[model samples]
Target: MEAFEVIQPGPLTTIQDLGRYGYQQYGVPPSGALDDYAFRTSNLLVGNEEGAASLEITLFGCQLRVLQDTTVAVTGADLAAALNGSPIPGWETVPVRRGDVLSFPRLKSGCRAYLSVVGGINVPMVMGSRATYTKAGIGGLEGRALRKGDILRAAAARPVTGRARVPTAHLPAYDDQVELRVILGPQDDCFTEDGIHTFLQSDYTISIQADRMGYRLEGPRIPHRAKADIISDGIPLGAVQVPGDGRPIVLLADRQTTGGYTKIATVISVDIPDLAQTKPGDRVRFRQVSGDEAVTALREYERKIQTVKNSSA
Candidate 1:
């Protein structure tokens, strides 16, 4: 059904779900929401599945006009969202009417926000996913960021719904600095002991060159034992690769399928959402954890998500 009409397509608004999976071997990078936690929560609030496509708004919010009555939820960053000139809250569901204007006026926190409707933003799914990979011009409304005058259609959803909320304590916290947990391995031996210590102890700032692909950090160069190059190998999400210059690049959802740089550590999956919310100039520190600890954290994270999913919406 007809859903939203774009009045203003902010800076980098795009459609994303969980991501395009199992196609990495084909060199297709998984392009999805940077903040998957927010993305999933937004969907749950609107009675949609976790992977349902939604609008991922970057930095500032966009202006979208509702074309039908629908329950909508906005999650992640607080953008000072307003519905028809009245303030509306985030992390909860709100009923929007036909011709109602949903607009974002200011960015108060985080790097991105997700807007999910009763069904979901219905773009033809490519590669088993509705994610937009702009670099290759593949999924999502023409495979690019949302454009003005774009008419977004929504998938059909079932009846029987009310309001849902993610408790304030459950919401993600944002600050100037965030500590990301990592499991050093796979290529950690390539770096000297001092390099590992620097990576785990020192503070690094997100460089101006941050994007969906990766984040280049600027800080003390991590001392490599000899070289930083490696045989071309598959690069996983959140892989922290140290290049010849010693700067580390934290690969993200849109990272290349294969790379030659030596990866020093990998940010844990549960913590990647925190990393995704970081903006340029944010300070980051890494903490090393054991494989078992990382697995336990992931299990706990999934449990929390399931708990929220079971709530009455």
Candidate 2:
């Protein structure tokens, strides 16, 4: 089978599509790309379907040797990637030949990166998705991160000549501090007005406890009007759940199926990628927006993605 040989699987690298859906009722977490913009862009650049399987590299990156001629595109974080020892620009489609080695020396910005080939990663679909949910040891390449010598097959049988490039205006800029828009939530009334003020006004530093499951923020305590306990409720993506200790945790793709803590707000869908790119020690600020505003923002985001897809096509 035509595939790329894993030479050095960096800190964390896994195959992921959009996500595993419709199985959440069975307690399955939606395991997908942290940065939706980058994931979709990478696929578009390589002429693959927007939800095609791609590699999500975290903090660091890996090295891979092409076993066949193929077209590839790297998106999300700038990992200072190189092809055959020469620096190769990301966010643009590039061709690789058999035996060509790709490496990422260091991270320049952002927390994760996505690598996509013309044909998506040809991993077997589990629950209708090739996404990897590492916690349960399901999906992806062997239901885990890739290891040295592992082979990743591509869906495309032959190399493609697609030459897509993401516009600079569409690219995201990463920083140590990010502002995430939120919608005051189902449990907002549980928090005191002062607590809501503190949450909206204060800067919460991303704690080391941050992971794919959630981002624990360390900052001023958010006082509750009563108690911080809630009947275990369905945890939504980007749910800002606050525990008894008063710290807020913004849930992400791998968040638990249910959470008992009171959720004060939900990070807007459009800003989830910005939060996902944040690393430990980074600062986060929340801004409250009306539900209508959030819906408009999401629609705008969808239009932006559609524009890129149209251009690529």
Candidate 3:
């Protein structure tokens, strides 16, 4: 069986797929790749299924030794990657042979990167997904991040004819500033009109407290109509919740199943990748959009993904 041995587990490396489903009722978080576009497209570049498991490398990258011959692709944030002392480009498929050492030395831009091999990471699935929820220690390899000396196996490697590359236009730009379109929330009425205006107009800086769970932005405090508390409700990905401190925390893939904070808005699906790629100091601004517009934007993104998949096929 083909496998990889972790030489250096940089920062936080973990296996992730589309995420665990139908289990949030049990307080389980859908701990999938933060950057979905990178995760999905990287798998495609390596000729793997859309939901194939890949390594979500955070902040920094890791060093791995190929135990068997296979092909791999690196996408999302460009952590300066090199293969056995030679510089190698990311965002494209690269062939590897047994004993080749892949290392990510620097994090040039973006916060996370996806490393996809020809065969998906063959980790045991929990609740129908292989995503790693570190908090609960469920799914993925022992439900935790990759560690040094850990050996990872792939399901099966498929034949490849040539290198596959994602076009520049299809790639995401990890600029210092990102604007995410949001839909006014299920609890938007809890906030005053000025609060909504502040949320849409003011700029927020991603705080160091930001993590897979949620991004705690530091900016103007958004005033609530009465209190910031809410009868604990189900939380969704990209939920913009404000607590007593009035600071907005945008929940992410690993967010708690429910939150007591009032959710003023929800980021549209199309802007998730951009939000996910932001680092601690990145600037974020929100724009309001109608529910209908949000649906149209999502459809457009899906259409692009399908087009890429079809072309590659």
lDDT of 2 at 163: 72
Mind sharing the TM-score for model 3?
A: 0.98
TM per candidate comes to 0.98, 0.97, 0.98
Error of 1 at 2 (Å): 1.0
Off by over 4 Å in 2: none
Q: What is the total number of backbone clashes in candidate 1?
A: 0
Off by over 4 Å in 1: none
lDDT of 2 at 37: 91
In candidate 2, what are the lDDT values of residues 1-313, reduced to their tens digit?
A: 5669999999889999899999989999988998899999899887888999999988775999999888899988888989999999888888998999999879899889899987899989899889999989889998998999999998854456657788777888989899999999979999999999999999999999888889999999999999899888899999999999999999999889887899999998899999888899999999999999999998988888887787773
Q: Cα RMSD (Å) per model?
A: 1.1, 1.1, 1.1
| Candidate 1 overall lDDT versus native | 0.90
Q: For residues 1-313, could you state the per-residue lDDT of candidate 1 as single tens digits?
A: 9999999999989999999998998999998998888999889888898889999998875999999888999998888899998989999999988999999888898888899987789999899999999999989999999999999999887643667888766778877799999999779999999999989989999999999999999998998899888899999899999999999999999899999999999999999989988899999999999999999999988877776787737
* lDDT, each prediction: 0.90, 0.90, 0.90
Evaluate model 1: give its TM-score. 0.98
